[model samples]
Target: MTGSHGLAAAQKGVQDSGNPTHFNFFRSALRGRQRVLWCANDPTVCLDREKNPWGGSTCCYQRFCKDTMSDPNHCGACGKTCAYGFVCCNGNCVDIQNDARNCGACFEECPGQSRCFYAMCDYGG
Candidate 1:
């Protein structure tokens, strides 16, 4: 959990209402009187804590991965972004910047890695 993408902001301690164990996922954003909505038994995304230069929170979090409730690869997970650049393929995280289906966004190729073709290997298409 020490990668560059780890949820460092969430390290601050906070009150865990009812289910205390699972509140860590969003504890960082709910600080300083910020109201939060706990969906289901636990939630990964709380309220917006990042204020723009204009001092306003984006109420909607298209960029915040934790807000995608139905995205299996990202849901209930904080700061854990889908690798392959945000495409879901066969329940696997794919970086669309080079994935076959999302060649640029849906399909991307990892550096020095070949596409899995017919149990064979090739540099790239």
Candidate 2:
């Protein structure tokens, strides 16, 4: 079977393992096919191998895997929130403050005719 198909079949047969973050999939051989084993809570096995094979990166938080380095909601660490007008910049939450690109708020860019200053959208030329 194709990888996606196999993943779908495995997911369909998943069994909860008491822990909210843990799951197990057991699939018996069908028509002489080999058995399949899937572990949801294993970062190396499930996340690194299956979910993020290329990136091979993940962080667990509240029963979910996250990329704390860039995720604004969990920047640097889980539950480390960024304010509405701020963003996760290199693992730290930061507001516009002095950024011309995100003037006054996250993703709020200053117009070409103006410059950003003191967290305001428009300022001196």
- Name the lDDT value of residue 63 in candidate 1: 38
lDDT of 2 by residue, 40-103 (tens): 4664442465455423334555555565656787787757888886778656787777777767
- What C-alpha lDDT, on a 0 to 100 scale, does residue 95 get in candidate 2? 71
Give the number of the best model, judged by TM-score: 2
TM-score, per-candidate, Cα-based: 0.23, 0.42
Backbone-clash count (model 1)? 13
lDDT of every model, 2 decimals? 0.40, 0.59
RMSD of each: 14.4, 13.6
Task: Name the regions of candidate 2 deviating beyond 4 angstroms.
Answer: 1-40, 43-57, 100-115, 118-122
